[model samples]
Target: MTREARQEALERHGLVESGDGFTVTLKGFQKAAERARGLRAQGNQEAALMLALEPSDPVRWEYARCLQIDTFSTEAYESGF
Candidate 1:
């Protein structure tokens, strides 16, 4: 990033103190913790959803299929691609 952009980000967020080697402020650490917590919550939700689905369910089946995971496999593949 350009120097101007970096300076702007630092000033706008107030997440770090402009000092010897750039120390992280409490707000910065809190933000990081919040992000980590959110990610963990999302992972747990995904795991619970996966576990709740029957093994024979289309979603479970699709989870193991690369084409299904990456794209519109069922209709698109049948339509010839």
Candidate 2:
């Protein structure tokens, strides 16, 4: 997806972009988790898992938690949870 689309997704998922624009949101975290899962599902398990395991802001803590619970043994939980 385009950067705009990604930004919109983050907003839709309840993430607000900081004034500096570098901060990560709950939505962005969730999107990353989703991207990871999608990559895994497409047989790119390494990439998918990597995406999910990246660090995010506290705002995304909840989103990461959810992804962790869902993915369980995956590295997504390591970064997100």
Candidate 3:
């Protein structure tokens, strides 16, 4: 299908949002990344974008993998996690 068709289809029926105020937010960044990868593998760009909880793909730098990230997150810390 063409890009426009995909976009229109998603606009009518999407995965994350039901065209309502509701939106999906996946727990755990890594897990959400995996889900996005799977969605892209299955279909067109617009569909994948609409379906994936996050519109953007996850980026993990090679250097990041080597480090043990223990930085304090205000969101996580504030939640008493």
Candidate 4:
């Protein structure tokens, strides 16, 4: 999808743009994260984990790490830290 289409979907899904210009909404974030995981499950590992990330989240770095590990493993591993 185009950036504009993604933005429209986000808006239609009730994600609001914060002052910082990033989308912010718990429901939307969760949905995006879930979508990301589904992408992984469907063998779209890169797209899946990319969708799971929120730049402002403190856990973003960890999520990236998880993505790397997830790429190599058949089973998902939880971050211990």
Please report the candidate that would top lDDT against the real structure.
Answer: 2
lDDT per residue for candidate 4 within 1-81, as digits (tens), equals 455755565454435555754443555545546656777788996755465556565565345434333432322122211
- Give the C-alpha miss distance for residue 79 in model 1, angstroms: 39
Worst 10-residue lDDT window for candidate 4 reads: 72-81
Candidate 4 steric clashes: 0
Compared with the true structure, the alpha-carbon lDDT of candidate 2 equals: 0.51
* Per-prediction TM-score to the true structure, in the order listed: 0.36, 0.36, 0.25, 0.39
Find the 10 residues in a row with the least total lDDT in model 1: 64-73
Model 2 quality (TM-score): 0.36
Report the lDDT tens digits of candidate 1 across residue range 40-75: 577855535544566556554333232222222233
List where candidate 1 sits over 4 angstroms from the true fold. Answer: 11-22, 44-81
RMSD of 3: 17.5
Report lDDT (Cα) of residue 55, candidate 4. Answer: 59
Q: Which whole-number lDDT from 0 to 100 does residue 79 have in model 2?
A: 43
- State candidate 1's TM-score: 0.36
All models: lDDT?
Answer: 0.42, 0.51, 0.35, 0.50
> Order of all candidates by TM-score, from best down to worst?
4, 2, 1, 3
